[model samples]
Target chain A: MRIETKTEKFDEPLHLESGRILESFELVYETYGELNEDKSNVIVICHALAGSHHAAGRYANEAKPGWWDKFIGDGKVIDTTKYFVICSNNIGSTFGSTNPLSIDPSTGKEYRFKFPILTISDVVRAQMKLYDRLGIEKAVAVIGGSMGGMQALCYSIEQPDFTDTVIAMATTAYTRPWAIAINKIAIESIRHDPAFKDGFYDPDDLQAQGLPGLAIGRMAGLIAYLSPELFNSKFGREYARTDGLYELFGRFEVERYLEYNSYSFPKVFDPLSYLYICKTMNIFDAGRNKDKLEDSFDKVKCNLHLISFKDDMLFFPEEMEEIRDIMIKLGKQDQITYKMVDSQSGHDSFLVEVEKFEDHVRDILKGK
Target chain B: MRIETKTEKFDEPLHLESGRILESFELVYETYGELNEDKSNVIVICHALAGSHHAAGRYANEAKPGWWDKFIGDGKVIDTTKYFVICSNNIGSTFGSTNPLSIDPSTGKEYRFKFPILTISDVVRAQMKLYDRLGIEKAVAVIGGSMGGMQALCYSIEQPDFTDTVIAMATTAYTRPWAIAINKIAIESIRHDPAFKDGFYDPDDLQAQGLPGLAIGRMAGLIAYLSPELFNSKFGREYARTDGLYELFGRFEVERYLEYNSYSFPKVFDPLSYLYICKTMNIFDAGRNKDKLEDSFDKVKCNLHLISFKDDMLFFPEEMEEIRDIMIKLGKQDQITYKMVDSQSGHDSFLVEVEKFEDHVRDILKGK
Candidate 1:
């Protein structure tokens, strides 16, 4: 029931689709629950743009609960009692994993932008290798929300024989137009961040410039993650401080909330890692496989569950329906279940609206 | 009918709501169209953040069309052919007007962030001084969009006798939660910009620091101005150089669009301007008049026209209807018209889809 870490070097080079080769890289991952003797209970949870391998439970007394801590506890849909779970920080992530901030073996310096433009498939491929190393022949399911959903879909298709159940939440098979634009803006914000300095500034010197920029960039993601109504209700023109003698000092509560969100990030996340994950998310479109969506779905060999939210503007529920229909056309209707969760948490319902989302996960974990 | 310039200086210190005083200040403005013999044709146009006195007509041979040129042309709404028009750059804006960027007469240094916080009503009060200098006693209408719309609403309530008719377009009556969040991010981005150097770095030193940070901040605005559908339809998965190539290069049309926008701005806008304008906009809320919505509208002297774009997620059209309903309850129903323009351009339709907006203007200006 506790998350465990594993570290290893890739036996060979990670040949990215761009023809760039990253040689003999180290990967760090963590697994939760217990791997059944047959390893059939394996369920992989992919994290979002800023998430890490810590999807549930605590590693140390000082560490906070996992990213989806609310929904992944005992008796939850992703029950530790019934299933073995694995969550790996993406290769280009900063969480206990090799990423741009990781020291390069050749130069002993952080790779930074020298890190290859990573694709979601590349991350999935690395995860597959980890599965192979762990003796997990085929998983009962692979599930994730947002970028994690992207990986789940990619894994279900590219290596379908390895994953028999795929649940993609608050995501699309391919990066949509608006999502792509938002991704590009986030990247541009990171690149143009003066401290970025073409991604070559000294790590020590880069902190001051890059950290604040990263905070603002993360706040941008926060906007898409939460509902505007929620923001209004919470912040609603409320002032944080009063000048005493007939005056308003602080801004509405929402302004303070966004500031808190932006500032808290630079203290935790690396700017380069933020950029890498965003880039991988933007390039993740299963429909890009063989220039057709069906060709991509044709490779999926799983009981698929496409879960979406009514007010999730970033990842439209309609997009999930399209993916569900594709699975049905592939004659996997009985194996695939599609449900639109009515929630106003925007695209972040999977992480916050645990009561409802947990039920969906339970249905899948129970194989109902 | 030609746009004419006028200037006036405050005889005493102007007291701001924030309890700060701006001592001995000047206001500059331009008038388009013509005033009727009774001066009843006067219609004032308030500009958005960073907008200017050059709201219509050419100022110089190479001058680009004014920001609202599409809305204030010969045959356009607020037409020069009939109603007299007056447009002024706000008191703290950087466009041919007195602002934080202006040299302080006392120390000969730019005010920078030292400029006191200004409210929407304060801006209208400054514009009113320009009218007094031009010998115009009152305006028949007050019209604007975004921050300009906030000023228009403020004028209708704060100075109803001078602003007989009001038109607030593509904007909300108050600084909604989302607007506050965007402004917070923008301000935070500028503060993090090293070239800003706590708002004291030499302008020359900003080329390496302030410009890029400002560019990134502006890019966020570009995303809100356009709709997601427009972005997808125009640049869905189209790549430049090849598929999945991620770098600073523009692979998708939307990338090129955003890149062009980001680069084009830093050349003209200063980091301080970005900070100041964002602060001014975030503090804008006309409904704050005596802390009662009805009390605010009771001061309005004439008809009201509120136009919103249905697809404007940044400033939802539903918020506009809510505002219109407030006007109706104030016994102005017969004089008020609430309409939503169906467009996929989102908040940018006021500039992009001008033809469709012209009809609404015709209805408002016909009697004059």
Candidate 2:
């Protein structure tokens, strides 16, 4: 099915966790299928870092379908024909959402550094507001992977009655040091760019330079998203252009792949939005304010499904298992389901290699 | 033993693999213990990336000893009393050696881009020249770890009669795609820094700026050199100073660790040297110019010992095992031995945790 993004302006002020007010904003989102009589078939999809609200279906002139098109279209895994799907381009995201580049009403300039730092809760709350406006009440499920998965779990914790089910894939309850280290490197890559000028860089400069800073971070993130085994298999020790081996700056096939994929990122993405969103992801902790992590989920009343890939280097299998064991230890085993997909695709498997774990998701979501 | 670095100038022209000539250069090196009458007790140590010639002994007024001081002392594993140790700072490195920042006699200016790109073979050849001048006919052994391991293995492959023993630790025979990808990211991290200015920037600027470019790459490399488990264990999810969590740049303990370690690097290290050395490391292949990898070791006469750490994420145990299997396939099993140390310290374990693998090295070197 063909789908179009819809932008709805929200005049209501959003009170963030940091006590900063987002006065006027717009939520860019998309929906699929019809709302059944009582609207029990609603499903909200949370996008990961660097992902857009475009979860499924193809736009008119797009070469490829939405990021999760294969799993959300008619007769697909989520079966848009049966369930109405809504995905909001999160605030602090560059995909037509109110972000760092969006103009502030107080002054006629972009928010830039003035944009309040965000938490995962702020992102979840913004989506919640969008859901409230869309007449989405007590939805069937909240499904997400990676940072999106954090949001999925957050929805259950913050508003236990918001969704009947929560499917979190390839993510952790709290950020680990390794993940934080990599993220810090990515942030530094952007900041060290002289053109960045402390987040006040001109859009034209990025348009011309093609995101030399963000490109480095993007390549790093892309590499982290895939297993080293997958990297070795996909692009072995072969030169894309081998004039000589001892030559300086010889191009490897993998280097070429990274360049090709990240070339167009800067043209469409705002660097400030990237910086702010990364901070949101970096500081995310589901257990904050609660004495124990188990206490954070004590009031949770939704069926929780933990999905992971064995080769996911970013959020490895052990991390996902820890969350599963925690839920089981908290005596919530009856409402929790855990599945590990044996794919060599790494963290990207949650989005790209869905076929490997679709059966598990179907069994949980569709009662198959 | 107390030691001092000695610099020897060589007027003879050196032919590089790139068909470039380095007319005049200096080799700065350090040695421990007295050479035997026959000079047969010589044990040459090849340094890894960012390492100095001082492998053992404390310099006057220095807070710490050499990088591998623990492994080599009067009665230590390598046994300075029995074997004379020599470690030469490679040509492309910083520490008082001829490098990219050194003045070129032809142009009377810093070599910078004029400095030829180096290979593992080229570095090994330079060390051979240094040995020739030092009146060392043949060494009892050549030992190294990480990039040094590549040189140790290269010594066996390049010159079959150079040494009796070649102990290589925590390294790869050939740089793989995963490694190349990371090296590319590190290169980009430096090159993208606007202050880098194509390696033409003034030294004072680097001193003043404290090498934001190199710092970013160094941080990335530091993280890669460590295992995730080690990082988690050493610096958990605690903030260094958490006044508030939602603050944009609230530092994690790991972040503080990276900043602290990398802060001192720029003052002692040259960014240009780092760039060229990383390139040398990136293109290293012990099997170069061979019909097969096994063919490269066909001429090796040394008792080769391969040492690895189980948790080395950078050069994982699998890569080291592959080389051992290759040696066995070449029918050199009797001449080759492999030992893997069960240390969770990752690639840096070779420098930091010698205790874990000292017994293996002692047995191989001392023929116990």
Candidate 3:
């Protein structure tokens, strides 16, 4: 189970377009490194779907280091010893963040399924507002992977003056048709479950029904997160548990892994939050601007570094090539560099592959 | 809808292990070409999962040619003019073959779920019995794909004198952990349905609960049969239909295609046969002879041709390479040739790709 934390004092409430006031929502964040005297060396790291604010180091007695622990710390990439790093859970997230599960003023009940949908820009704007309230004028660099990569691109385009450099890895400016299809199926699996009750089910009534459908959906997601070659090599025709039950039932290790991961999610996550994050991601597309590649990519002004994996079936290398070609065609080649890494870990390589990824980040920071 | 035709008749009654004699089991067969003087130029082709007796050519009233028509008709690779070809629906198949729907002798009621679980060897033996009754001493070739390929391999190993050449395309000597996992999950989907009742549900009881489960299972099966690249190229996030009913519903063409195919399967297929065929395929491992690679390869006297696809993710090309290396080690390199075709269709390429596959077969037949 995940522990939700709230700050006792908030500077002010946020005013929304609906004329509703969100009174003092806390920003769930995990920080590393001390802020420099000039405060000019702060870097913000965004996370992907289902990722929390815990970006590095052990957090609140957790056994494992945070998600990107390898890339942060005393003398690593970004040199935590020299740079202040602020990573926050998105506003629409469930992990100690002010998501639908937070108490709603309108009814004095948890938002549950009543939270309005959010866009990537909505998330970025909220984070920017938080930074402004905290007296941070700009980030030396903004970086993310997958959904986080998406947030970085959005920030670079929408708030160019606040970020000097942007790094987007194992992600896209927009969700492609294939990615959209995959997300759509996963959402359907969750929503179509009878237990979902149109996303308004009682929290106490959640059952295995919604879990299995969601599990199967996550299994599909896991496939996209992995390369076909890796799957063939590691789990090909291999049983997860070699007891006699497998011979009678035909179970594989990957299937067991997927099932365990999916079931374990609800223990810490709210179902409504899962739905909201996926929906936010579905509407995320960088190619939506002007319906042309040049106009869309031309809108971004941040010094950009784009990276992809050669074996990422979910985000094909060709998409990155297209992005690079567009930046070049738009006469921004000098401002951008594209690197395709060779890894069989697939899209998840962004998190799993740290040394090589940090080295690329350091080289970019050195302006090489 | 596919039309089922019961044409060929078996004269002898067969005794079952169930202590009952089956009066008359019909052989649903499709034939190509005319028999030569000694009837030694006959080739028997077996159908794989969901396949039927119509291996090639169009039926009189149908517009579409048989599934394998492109590679098996006159002037084609399995040239009907040169060698007589016979294709049969396996005993446990629902496509006009003796299956669960067949009447039981004791109760005079449709066996329905009473059908015994079958093995690959059992299916092969049934075909041999059919061949013996047909008065054919030997076949010029025995060829099949996927599950059919398993039957071909079993036939050559169990009765080498009956076959001169064996073509096993896109198949495995044993079911790997991955394949079994996929098959079991599919079966579980069917079994968990309320209407299944341990496969005792009435066939006439349409709109059964198992249909949805079967549809999802088939969708899973279809994804396994396709490559990520093929799906990416064909279905990438192009939305065909959108209703306010759900946000993350299908937004891509391929997801829609998979759902469409799965929905169509229930109109014709019996759920029990699907279970039986899957079980048979899972336990099929011809390499269990546990002999040395050379000894095992040398045990098969028939000429062998193994063809694989580069993108066939289900049966990896590496597996085929292993089989090829073993054949060469046995000094059968002169008699056995291996070919890997480039196709984006994945495992289904053996049926979808014709020109290249047919050319390879023709060259092999001409002793090239």
Candidate 4:
């Protein structure tokens, strides 16, 4: 199974949910395995915030595989051999996509804050266009977790007759207030960074400014990604190496862990992209109205599988149950299934602890 | 009952657990009721981080009373008529205490980052000194919640005979990695603010700088102080007052609520004090070693009452149960009582929803 990435350019304008337009853009995507006749074996995988189109396998020199490598490799649960996998860099994402950091051809300047707000529906629509270019008449299934899960939900509603199945894991049908509140900390941190200069700072100068604001925002986001149980078990009350607890800038092992994971994140990620993506996540409302549950799911033709992690405080398992209940109320209980994996990794379980649900996912992908 | 706040100066240097000293400081405290014969009815109340000595009563022109006004009034739970209550502003708090923003007598400049890191023991010792100044041999009880709860636990062990009872609520015996991780977010937020100026910025210029970092930090802190259920029920998916969710810097009702509470927090709070106090909390361990629980409570003479909020995610109820379990293992089951109040206010229940535990507090104070 050869793994390769290619860019597909579209000269046609993309009308966004915000009523803004992307005059022209490129979608960088990766494909694994071979597309069978008619391309009906295709499985489109959506990536979460901070993720990329490189969903599986490693590059020539990289130490780690892609974000969901363990779950999507040749003989893994997702089984690339059995399904042709396609993953695209989301439009507002920093990874090789036409994001906020991309230069505007008309003005020869980075879009930055000028990047229009995006929604899950907009992201899904762009991927559908990529599918059109790839000659994929319809995907066998659309699979995702977290923000990617939001995109999966969008795929079901936006193109009800396209895919046969939709798998959304560790996410909400709609973003909750708790999640929005957490996003505010990150936005405020970046907005307050003196070096941010209203998102117009030279990319070259970010290293000198330490991107302190972006690092802080990443740190805040990291807290929500993992759970308190994981933190206590892994780094309980431990002091940072070679530092007394009373020393200036002294850190607990947990603080050191956060700084290690987030401090250099700005060098690899775009702050404006982060800000924009968070706004998209904040406004996500798949089942737009609970009172009109039937209307909300009226267009759905795919079999829906809503997978949740029990300990995920960010998205919360109950919120997913709310979606199942809505479908049940609409007399679509037979069309939808909800599974909660007993996990302590919080929302990160879908990526790092996929073993917990690997068998179930394999079965679902098999339509068993 | 009448309430008055007065400052008591101490020429003696205060030794800290960090092996540092606060030389010749003032302890500002508010008192209610009268000292009885032998001065035995004194109830020393401890304040948490961001708290003040003003525990009860309002000024002539003020619209609201003190932080714990409901629980500490003349006929309230603590019952000032029967117990003379004393609440002191912690040394490193932003209130009227000798904090980091206070002038250093030696240099005639603000202490700023020069303030020594404090522990719950140091705070407890300082309050005991105030007792010595008033010629009081001991207090009837030491009561507090959250970080103040840390102090109540400290009083039981630090000065076994200083008080006959210790009521610690919505707090942990030691700060968990989970909590240290959250405090890290706040510290990072404040530290990254360019206006922070290495904690050397002019206090007069903070307002002009907008104190963005402090506001960001406070916003993060506010999240843990509340539970998800409260956020969901109160704000849900409501749009802000005027702007729709798609507007620039557009916000959900919950984000608006957080902004309203945290945006102006820096104007009234000192960032340096916040940094110093968080360090104290991160290192707090009342029962120093689980294996040597006996040693930690060896000289403890007070009856300990540990109260917890059911929804407290910050200082979890299980952590409080761990303390009680330790006491039970030490064969002191009869000496300690644990109470869990069902509430959705999280760690803030100890401050805002004390009504749920008022009867219990009154009974415990009455030795019932």
Name the top DockQ candidate.
Answer: 4
On residues A1-368, what C-alpha lDDT tens digit does candidate 4 reach at each position?
Answer: 67989998888899988888999888899999889887778889999999999999998899889999988978987778888999999998988878888878778988876778888998888888998887888888899999999999888877997898999999887888889998998888888787888888887788655688888888888898889888888887788778877865799889999999888888888888889899999988886654554576767888899999988979999988988887888788888999999998988999989889999888887752
Candidate 1 Cα errors over 4 Å, as ranges: A103-110, A193-197, A201-210, A242-252, A289-291, A325-335, B10-13, B105-109, B203-210, B241-251, B289-291
Indicate the docking level reached by candidate 3. acceptable
lDDT of each: 0.76, 0.84, 0.72, 0.86
* Residue A165, model 4, lDDT: 93
Task: Name the best candidate (by lDDT).
Answer: 4
Q: What tens digits encode model 3's per-residue C-alpha lDDT throughout B1-368?
A: 12234466665665543344556676787778887787887888988888888888776898778778878877778888788888989887888778877876668988765666566776776777777877899998899988988888777677778887888888877666556645644665566555556777777663443365566567667777787678767865455666331243423466568767876776667887787677677667676433443555667888888888888866777766777788787777876778899888988998998776887887767841
Candidate 2 lDDT by residue in tens digits, B149-258: 99999998887888888999999988877777777776777777767787888977787768777887788788879988998899878787754666666788888888
Residue pairs with backbone atoms closer than 3 Å in model 4 (clashes)? none
Global Cα RMSD, each model: 3.0, 2.0, 4.9, 1.7
Best by TM-score: 4
Candidate 4 stretches with Cα past 4 Å from truth are A105-108, A207-209, B105-108, B207-209, B289-291
Each candidate's DockQ score against the native complex?
0.49, 0.71, 0.26, 0.76
Residue pairs with clashing backbones, model 3: A173-A286, A174-A285, A174-A286, A177-B237, A178-B237, A237-B176, A237-B177, A237-B178, A238-B177
The TM-score that candidate 4 achieves is 0.97
Per-residue lDDT of A67 in model 2: 88
Query: What C-alpha lDDT, on a 0 to 100 scale, does residue B173 get in candidate 2?
Result: 88
As a whole number from 0 to 100, the lDDT of residue B66 in candidate 1 is 77
Q: State the lDDT of candidate 1 residue by residue for A216-298, as single tens digits.
A: 77777888788778777667777666322122224556766787777777656777787777777777778775268888888
Query: By the TM-score metric, which is better: model 2 or model 4?
Result: 4
